[model samples]
Target: MTKALTPGSIAPPFARYSHAVEIPAGHRLVVCSGQLGIDSQGDVPPDVEGQTRLCFANIAAILAEAGMDLSDIVRINAFVTGREHLPGYMKTRDEFTGSPPPASTLMIVSGFARPEFVVEIEVIASAP
Candidate 1:
């Protein structure tokens, strides 16, 4: 299980995530690379919501490749090109990973890996 970090007399973390994540002491960590919305055919969808969905799908696929599932994800770092599109991305994300959502970091970068990709999602999985 993962718990969201909260400062207790310490300085806050620089990153805008919910804070840090408290991973179990004995869990092995899995750091997944940033996942872009582009498909294997070398294409990125124009729609921000669609791209966000695909990006997460790619991340989940990577987890499966490592013999894990969304439940194993302790943290996530996502980058969206346009801050205005956050709601749409969040909606799609909820559809993909319902209930006890993993701890996450959402960033609004100037842009993404490709111009057409409006959103990119990355994940960190831990196994106890």
Candidate 2:
């Protein structure tokens, strides 16, 4: 099992996710590249919520390719183009992971590689 950490000395995380995660011994790590909302046909979603959903879909596909799933995720890094998208991002994220949630960092960035892209997500997971 992955251990989610919330150290007593620090302020609690502002949202879902732990301060850190301690992967158990003997588990290997899976680090995924940043995923955008572009689909298999190469279309990017126009809206942040749609893009966020697609990002998770892409992540799930990568995890499946590695023989793992969301439960194995120990950490995530999310980048959004704007602040308004955060609520949707959090809702979609909570739907995917986190009984306790994985450690995460969310950032508001100026933009993405493509003008249409609204969000990007990357993750680090544990595998037995």
Candidate 3:
């Protein structure tokens, strides 16, 4: 199992995430591509929270393919178009992340491949 690391010498995480994670040896790793909010029917949600949920759903599917689940994730990299979308993204993200929480970074980016997309998420997972 992975260990959440938050050294006492440093400040605590600002949000619901670990500062870092220690992945043990002999574990297989999976690095997923950044996933947009579009659904199977090619529909994109207009709201950030909706989009964030879809992002996690898409990530779950990818992890499933490798015999892993959301709980196996050790790090997360997320991007939103603007600051206004931060709360919505974080709320939805908390629902998907497991106990001990994954190391995470949320950034405000100018945009993505499409203008309609408000959020994007990518993750790294490890399992023995």
Instruction: Give the alpha-carbon lDDT of every model.
Output: 0.75, 0.90, 0.96
Residue pairs with colliding backbones in model 2 are 98-101
Per-residue lDDT over 1-128 for candidate 1, one digit per residue giving the tens place of the 0 to 100 score: 67767667787654334456677789888899888887888877888787877787788888888788777777777888776878887778767663345667778999854577778788888877
TM-scores of all predicted structures: 0.79, 0.95, 0.99
lDDT of 3 by residue, 1-128 (tens): 89999999999999999999999999999999999999999999999999999999999999999999999999999999999999999999999999899999999999999999999999999999
In order, how many clashes per candidate? 0, 1, 0
Candidate 2 whole-model C-alpha lDDT, 0 to 1: 0.90
Q: Is candidate 1 or candidate 2 better by TM-score?
A: 2
Scanning candidate 2 in windows of ten residues, the lowest lDDT window is: 91-100
Candidate 1's TM-score reads: 0.79
Task: Give the lDDT of residue 67 in candidate 1.
Answer: 84
Error of 3 at 120 (Å): 0.4
Residues 65-124, candidate 2, lDDT per residue (tens digit)?
989988888999999988998998888888889567999999999998889998999999
- Local lDDT at 59 for model 3: 96
The positional error of residue 78 in candidate 3, measured at the CA in angstroms, is 0.4
Off by over 4 Å in 3: none
Find the 10 residues in a row with the least total lDDT in model 1.
12-21
RMSD of 1: 3.7
